[model samples]
Each structure stands twice: as structure tokens, then as C-alpha cells.
Target: AQTVTQSQPEMSVQEAETVTLSCTYDTSESDYYLFWYKQPPSRQMILVIRQEAYKQQNATENRFSVNFQKAAKSFSLKISDSQLGDAAMYFCAYRSAKTDKLIFGTGTRLQVFP
Candidate 1:
């Protein structure tokens, strides 16, 4: 069984600052996918970023980037120049290319102080 771990249950950052949320997973499969999803208080799950196991390069989306260490099974999200809009519950998720259901970590609550 695979499981995702998020050490930080809560985090805070000032507006325009950066924050790094840590995540790790236990999985035996080599070809799997990892994702970061954001849910504002509304509770809608939105895909933030994704990384494929075979890719050596990290994934970047505008102000968001991922530090993917495949060997360590660690995937962390870095929010650069954060904003108030970035304040939300960030969830680290994993999905096997061979499976459909998404396995999510507990969650990290991000608070952006303006």
C-alpha cells in the first residue's frame, strides 16, 4: 500500500514571500504520478501541478514549482512570491498511471498574511 505524508499540518507566509510545503510518499511502483491540489475554504479541489516519475526536470507553473526526489519518494511544493490568493489548503496527492483514484495526504493549511 502507498501512502502520502505531509509533515506540516499548517503553515503561514507573508504576502509576496515564499513558502515550501514538504511531502513524502511510500510507493514501490516506479512509473507513477504525483500532484498538488489546492482547496480554498470552498472545498473545491483544483489541480496545482503534476510530475511524472520518468521526468528528470521538475515541474513549474507560474509561481509554483516542485522539488521531486524520486529516489527519496519526496515531492514538495514551493510557492514563490506568494499572494493572498495562495492562501488555501494544499494537498499532496499521488496517482498511479495504472489507477484512477487519487491518494491524498492529510493536507497543509496555508495562511497568507497580508
Candidate 2:
């Protein structure tokens, strides 16, 4: 069984500031994929970034980046240059390559204020 955990239920950040969201996952599989998705009021799940378990380098996209520690089974997201548009619900997801089954965490609500 695989499960994802988002320790932070809610996070607030001021515009232009940076914030990091903590996420940890438990899985026995060695080959898998980790992802961070953001859903705003529009209710659409947008892919923020992704990482492969075998990859040593962390994944990054624009202002979003991930700190992936395969040994600790931890994957946290860092959002730089926070903006009001960044305010939304962020979800940590995991997918096993063998089963292709995706599991998601409860999510962390991020509030961006000016």
C-alpha cells in the first residue's frame, strides 16, 4: 500500500515571498513517480512539477521546485516569488510505474496575500 502525507493543512505567504509545503509518501516500490498538483477556485488540477524516484536531481518548473529525498520518502514543494494567483489547494500525488495507480494526499491550502 502507498500513501502520501501533507503535514501542512494550510499555509499563508505574502506576495513575492517564498513558501515550502511539506509532503511525505510511503511506498515499497522503487520505481515510481511523484507529482505536485495545484487546484484553484476553477477546480482544475494543474500539474506543478514531477519527479522520478530514480532521479537524483530534484524537479523544478518556473517558480515551483521539489526537494525529493528518496531515502526518507519525502517530497516537499517550494514555491518562489509567491503571487496571489498562487493561492489554491496543492495536492501531493504518487504513481507506481508497475501498477500505474495514482494516490493523492489530503492536500494543503495555500493563501497568498499582498
Models 1 onward score TM values of: 0.98, 0.99
Segments of candidate 2 deviating more than 4 angstroms: none
Q: Alpha carbon lDDT of residue 112, candidate 1?
A: 100
In the range 45-65, model 1's lDDT, one tens digit per residue, is 999999999999999999999
What clash pairs does model 1 have? none
Q: CA lDDT of each candidate?
A: 0.96, 0.97
Q: How far in Å is the alpha carbon of 31 misplaced in model 1?
A: 0.6
Indicate the worst ten consecutive residues by lDDT in candidate 2.
Answer: 20-29
In every candidate, how many clashes are there?
0, 0
Residue 74 Cα positional deviation in candidate 1, in Å, after optimal superposition = 0.5
Q: Worst 10-residue stretch by lDDT in candidate 1?
A: 93-102
The whole-model C-alpha lDDT of candidate 1 against the native structure comes to: 0.96
Tens-digit per-residue lDDT, 1-114, candidate 2:
999999999999999999999999998899999999999999999999999999999999999999999999999999999999999999999999999999999999999999
Provide the global lDDT of candidate 2 against the true structure.
0.97
